[model samples]
Target: MTVAVGLFGYAVAMAFLAPRVLPRLTRHGVHPNLGVAAWLSVMTSVLGSWGTAVLIAVADAAHTWLHADRLVLSGLHEAEVIVTGHEGLAAQLALLLVTAVPAVLAVILFGRLARSQVRMRLRAREHADALRLTGTRMHRHSYADVVLLDSAERAAYCVAGSPNVVVVTSGAVAALRRRELAAVLAHEHAHLMRRHPLLLTVTRGLAATFARVSLFPVGAREVARLLEMSADDIAVRRHGREPLLSGLLALSGVAPAGALAASGADVLARAERLVSPRTRLRRIRAALLTGIGVAVLAPLLVVGAASGLLLCLI
Candidate 1:
């Protein structure tokens, strides 16, 4: 009974958590990036909660198995063991206090932080309303506008709003021809259309949380890179490979901080991949296969593993 209860708890936790984590994984790869520090912290706390729940459930199962003669009150005995050990009530209460407090605090703190970021983003959108130019219908929603700024630095950035505008400096505009500019716009549009800022914001919280708990940071960073590629694909599809590639090369020279530049980092490689028909086919095939595999395997694997562990202890 204890084992059953533990397994049930595990299932509930996974049901809530996996959906949040997996989408981020596919949308972005799992890597560490500097930008998502706060989000990473929250994610780490989330992951930590997951880890704690798993551990508690396993321990509960094992304890019940070891003390099968106790009253068959479902997994209550196992839970008691987690809180008090096999000793007296005082020991159990002490254990529960020690474990439960931090776990609850971590959840509350991280959750608050995530909410704060969301609020800030919403506020940023409100601020952007004042900046909207006349005759531009782009601000109707959170769609990024691609505009020119008077700064000396040539940069491409999304101001992030209902019509989240992507801004490009005149220097960048002058450097690229019409097609290249279109490609740049397409890439930024993909970011806006996908609501990437929100996604990235969440991911950043996760990354920061993970870092605090000393878990893996690579997952969040990888997600960031993949999101960039996904946006690149959108650009390539809309504007053609040549234009996107040219835009990447041109923007690489003048990419700036705090802005999503069309080129820089892995932009060139992404452009090359876009231009290569073979690479495109392979990427499509791989993505399809991965999606199918995950769809089929996730439930079976998660359930089977959790059940098998419970049975082994029982």
Candidate 2:
């Protein structure tokens, strides 16, 4: 019970504080990849702590019940007798109800996450298939194949899957200067090489499944924005900021569902950043890493401390 309470309290505290603290810590000044890591760590830590608490509660209850007959003649004999009048079975049933609530909820949450992943992957595959059939192959790059659509809309996006593809429309091909087109292709290539689509998919699933968490929804949006910025950084390194900025301004279309477009996310903010990039201080980056480490380790420390206490008590 002590262990369970400690775990539950830690989970609640982190869930409450993480949303408030993350925005300030992972602002645009920090590296976007680091920000993504921080957000994912928080989400995993909260859910893992909660799940661990539930499991510990159920296990402790079962252990106590199984040893009830022995415990009646052991160190806790007097306390057990005085506390319950030997009504161990009744107490066990009540404990079962308490543990069952979270177990059931955990199952439902996992089911929702699974469904979301399946639906997203299926949609991505279907979109890939459609693009393969309708769009003509333009380049056979090693990282991702390029597909040319006949449309006049300036659409440029990448569909991630087996044999990943970068799709560009005729309008974009005509509208983009050679340098701008290269920058745009580099952006989509960065997405494929880094598996940004998969990252977005997982975040999207977590947000949809646990929207009430507040942190999950906000993390989803922030992760998407940061990922786009991260890709922009990669594109800039290979093709310079001007070409990518020009490409950003020239290309305009909504990305297909489950596909990442060069023009998707906050284009205006990306443009501004390209115009004037800010460098974070070394100390600030160090502090952010320290914070990430603490957040990731704190839950495990709680569980360990609780277990040690339980052992000493026994």
Candidate 3:
């Protein structure tokens, strides 16, 4: 009963409620990073609870159903159920599903994680090769390694895996003034110094493994956009707004795989704020933080309540 309830609760929330709650977080002015963290915490916690429930059910089945013909119903042993094939076929099928789904989910999660790591390494290497062949090494930025590509597509991007590489296309060099180029480089450096690549990779793993869960997909995208914004903030501090804004306008191409680029459509929304940066509203920030806290704790609440109720009924 405990296992059944936990499975039901997690599935329903992941498939339904999570999707609804995520957009609400954005509406409430939740910072993207905080929202991502909350979604990750909640999704992982629910998986944890579901895995525990499945293990308990499987162990119970192994000991009582396969090894013995009957189950002992606690200390008194007054009430009991048949544990072997004597039970109805429905009971056996339920037992099989209860034990199998969690294990399958675990396998799928690990497989996706391994695949993502492999893909990231390959992407990092490919970016390094592309830059080395088509680009020239430039004076290293204060915080990051740099390469300058001789291309006409206004692009500036950085990949921060083992072979960390930053590439700036010549188009950007020509399009952006000196200050703007410096600002763009600073933005890419911010990505490396902050280790945004690793963050995105982890979120990517979660998103791939739990694609059915809206939070995971939403969180992954939110993290990507937030990392860009966070880097923008750093660039603003380093060289003020105009340089960064100009660079952003000049270089608005898709970032290469495993790279954080200078401009994205997600950033277009931030232009107004660049002209007149306003303080984050305290109340909204607090509310968003609180929402994150609740998301982090919700899985525990669901499993705990289910456990309590099942215990009472039993």
Candidate 4:
């Protein structure tokens, strides 16, 4: 019964929490949350099963220690009690069925959903080469080869795989001055360099599989945001802050949809933040907080597992 309760609890936790936690972690730049959540869920299920098995073993051992005479006497008395009382084999079976069925269903549904997303991503990659549009000056970067293409509408896209390519439209190109253009390129390059898209895709797939998956989409988004800042830093260092800010302002006026534009929706805000005197301090504080949070959570999780194991023994 305790094993069933644990399984049910774990399934409920995963089904309810994975989807929400993953996105939040991704957004906050917390990378470890997803792994921790997955590990915890799996550990909970395994420990729960093991605990039940141990309980049954212990009960059997105790019965053996007590001998056959007690068993026979108790069995007759228990039968009589069951005839007069509410609890019986039927009630126990019903309880197990009620708990086990939902747990099994939750696992099955979430697993299938995650698998389907994986298959879709894999299939999307097959057509990546065919989706190529024409462009000149494929800027070779550590993360990806970015090409500037002529298109009526502005667009920026990342093609996944080895030697990943980031394609930008001519409209996007003509929209920014030289420095802004450089900043744009740097941003896209950072995305490739960090392998953000692939990580996000995998994380999403995992999150879909388990409802409690954490630090995937949100982490990906935060990484995307930080990489942009990092690239902006590079651009500022190479080209100067004025040019980068100007480029941001100029691009902000003509940002594109469905593309990582040189100007994103929050470019002005980012530009403002960059020039802010306290930005560096904030960055340092954020980093320190993240580190401290991870340090604290790691041990708590370990202790939780040990406690769960101890419960199983009892």
Candidate 5:
């Protein structure tokens, strides 16, 4: 009963609120990292409910198996073993089917993650090779892993892998003022230092899982954009507003394919934010949003615990 309730509640809440509420949470102009945190929390809770269902289903199946056959406990050693109406077989088959769904989904999810990691590694290696030939080592802003590539492309991207190198194309180095370059480099390092790509990959995993069903992916997409904002905030603090804004406009969309670029596609929105940043969210707003996220997550935790109790009771 608890498992059934959890499943029902999860479905209704996601179907009704996720598409709208998640976007609102992520779209808020302040503290984008906090919004991403909320998104992870909500999605994790929903995922927990799915796991609870699987466990409870397996337990119920096992309990039914024990009760459905009287002869096993009837003290009739000579009696023929029988399952009336073949309910035992049906129960086992249902359990198998229930288990198979999550199992298959897990395989696919991890396979995708592995493939993505490999692709990123390959891209990093290619960048490393390019750096060897046409690149000159530069004074590291934050660290010595920085390199300058002799290319006209207005790009500044981070290669996050074994080497974790940050590359600045010659065009950007020539075109941007010292402070502008500082802001761009600062932004990319924020991505590297915080490992924002892994965050994005995790969000993509969740998005792929619920791609056809809910508005969760919208939240994930918003999270990606917000991550960029998070980095922008860091850059602004280090080099002020103008440099970051100007650098963004100059190096916009110059990131190579398969690279995480500082000034990627959302140039206009980022530019606008730099012009007049949103009023930093107040503690009240933060508390309120945190409460809402906790509210959404709490039900799943309660339901999971209740389902576990049901499993043990039977």
Candidate 6:
């Protein structure tokens, strides 16, 4: 019970403070890939903390119900011992019932996340199947799963699935220069290669499932924006910024409902970023890496420490 309360408090504090601190820690997107990682790590940390807390609560409840000695921290053990001594089996039964609430809630929370991912993946697969039928397949040295849709409306998006499809409209191909089209294709391919869809799925699912949690929603938006920037960086690396910038200008339109568009999120900001001189914030990048490491390992470390202490007592 003590461990559970402490873990829950830590989770709450992280959820409240991480969003405020992470933007500064990411150094305003000096490295977009690292920024995406940092945001995802923080989200994972918060959720892990809550999950660990619930698990600890259930473990402690079961331990007390079965064992003669309490398996919690000394403070919690002392208080619970007093109650159980006075109230006997009633107190233990009540603790078990109380612990069951969080366990049930956690199951529901994760179930919703799983359901959201399944629905999204199914939608993306359907969209990809339709595009494959309607759109012409392109043979390119760099990318093979390219589909050219015969649409005048400029649109470019990647459908993430088994093969990972990149769909570009006829208007985008006609509007963009050769180099610009290649850059856009690189951008979409980067999305597939880096598995951005899975990232977005998890983040957005968390945001939707835990709408009341401030960090989940903020992290979702930041992750989406940063992933676009990350793909842009990859495009620039393969084909210079100017071409990608032109490509973005050509396809400055929203994508399909369940796809990640090259010009999808924060287009103006991405264009501005492309035009601006690049800065290699080495120090900030190092700091961000450190922060990501801490965010990922902190909850696990705490759980390890508590387990070690319990082992010592045993």
Best by TM-score: 2
Q: How accurate locally, in lDDT, is each candidate? A: 0.56, 0.83, 0.69, 0.51, 0.69, 0.81
Model 5 lDDT per residue over 60-136, tens place: 54554466565445343222132344446665455557646655675676587567666656766677667645778
CA RMSD for every model? 7.7, 2.6, 3.5, 7.9, 5.1, 3.0
Q: Which ten residues in a row have the lowest lDDT in candidate 4?
A: 26-35
Q: Between which residue pairs do clashes occur in model 2?
A: none
Per-prediction TM-score to the true structure, in the order listed: 0.63, 0.90, 0.83, 0.58, 0.78, 0.88
Q: After superposition, how far is residue 69 of candidate 2 from its true place, in Å?
A: 3.6
**What is the Cα-based TM-score of model 2?**
0.90
Ranking by lDDT: 2, 6, 3, 5, 1, 4
True lDDT of residue 235, candidate 4: 61
Answer with 2 or 3, whichever has the higher lDDT.
2
- How many angstroms is residue 309 displaced in model 5 relative to the true structure, after the best TM-score fit? 10
- For 68-138, candidate 1 gives per-residue lDDT tens digits of 55524544565555443467778666655655565566567668767767766776676456445522333
Task: Write model 3 residue lDDT over 9-103, tens digit each, in one string.
Answer: 66566646655766555532236456556656666655565666666666665665454534444321321233454566676677677667766
Candidate 3 regions exceeding 4 Å error are 1-4, 7-11, 27-32, 66-82, 88-94, 276-280, 310-314
Clashes of 3: 0
Off by over 4 Å in 5: 4-8, 66-134, 141-144, 277-280, 304-314
Write one digit per residue (lDDT tens) for candidate 6, span 91-159.
Answer: 656665688989999999999899998998888878778878898888542433799989898988998
Error of 6 at 80 (Å): 5.0
Least lDDT summed over 10 consecutive residues: which range in candidate 1? 29-38
